[model samples]
Target: MSRRYCLVGNSHLAAPKLAWEGVRAEYPAVRAQFYGATRKQLGELEVKNGAFGAHLRPTSKKVSRAVKRVSGGSDKLKPGSFDAVILFSLGFNFHQAEAIYRTHRTLDFNGSATAEHLVSADCFRAALRSLLEDSLAVKLVRQIRQISDVTIMLSLQPYPSEAILKDGWKGWTTLKAEGDVGLLQETYISAAADIAEAERFDVIYQPVDTLNSEGFTKQDFCENARRLDLAAGDVHPVKNYTHMNADYGERVLQQLFAADAP
Candidate 1:
């Protein structure tokens, strides 16, 4: 029998979903399903009696509809419904760690020699680990384990587009100008890997080609990115740097399945 896989995420699910939709025919031995919601709504999802669904409330209608639309008309997912579950970008990024660096510099930072308000390396690592532990992605993984020991894979949110530097975004600008961008990227990836190993899950980091020299997603893949609320083929506003276009999605799919292949 073919292995069944479910990809569950927030808005970031759009890329892989659209990519899979376009190229699924070439992979005849695998079956896949998709489930998506806003980051907030994903936090509200719960598994009840083996069924994963939203809580009953006024917004439940909108949430369920969106889920159904993206999930091919299925609004609820059962824990054992698939052989594997890939969690994509439900607050799984280095944003929290980067935010901390905006106010404090760590010893590993390249700019630390001249930087004020420096923090100990231990303190920086601890803060990043704590934030990752408390993230929605981590919580969902733990939640799924409560009832079933399904295989879980995590795909972190795409790094912001390099275009962010052009705008002088405080954190990106600081890191670009003086901080060790490479160290920050490595620490974030290492922390996530450590978390996955401890939890016995897997992680699929971005493909190397998708990253620019500064470790952000390339600007080419950043154009015409879609939002969760947009219809298929629609593009998000130009200012949105976090989402990615289907080309990026296609590469991600290739990376995922290549690693997953027998």
Candidate 2:
């Protein structure tokens, strides 16, 4: 029997959904479906009687339409029925790390960089763990565990485009200026690994080639990125660094379905 996989998350799920169309033929033994909603609505997803979904009814007309559109006419998924459930972009992001770095300096930031609120390595680790544990991704994982013991995989929100630095976002600018972007990347990887071990899920990071030397996604992969409601042609505005185009998705999926991937 073919493997049945469900990809669920917020808007970032768009990338994989679009990419899956071109690559599904290559993986004849695998079957995949997508379920997406806005970040806020994602939290509304509930698992009941071994099925998971947002409630679709008259009062939630907008969410109902969104569910149908992204899911191709389905509102719920029985994760126990699938071979794998990959959760993508449900609020695990590098920005949270940046936010921490902005307020407190850790030993990881080399050189005489002085911050009034320098934190011990142990304190820093505690903060990062707190952030990840509180994230929507972790919460959703715990909820899923309540009903299904299926394999769970996680993919973080795609790294912001390198164009983000050009736009002068304080988080990106500060990290780059402090020579801590690389450290940021390492931190993200390490934190992800720790979460996977603790939570018992697999993680799929962006393909290395898709990232620039600074650990941000290459600008080329971000142009003309679309929103979750793709059918409405909800393309992101210019200089939108957070979202990615289909090309980015294709590469990530290729890595994911590779024979050796977890």
Best by lDDT: 1
Please identify model 2 stretches exceeding 4 Å from their true place. Answer: 50-62, 259-262
The segments of candidate 1 whose C-alpha lies over 4 angstroms from its true place after superposition are 50-59, 114-116
Candidate 2 per-residue lDDT, tens place, 1-262, comes to 5778888878888888888888789888888888778877776666565223322121256765777788898777667767888888788888788788888878768622666588887787779878987888888788778777788888878889988899998767877888888876787778888988898888888888999888889999998887888777778988788888889888877776772244
For all predicted structures, in order, the TM-scores are 0.91, 0.91
Q: In terms of TM-score, which candidate is strongest? A: 1
State the TM-score for model 1.
Answer: 0.91
| RMSD after CA superposition, every candidate | 2.7, 2.8
TM-score between candidate 2 and the true structure:
0.91
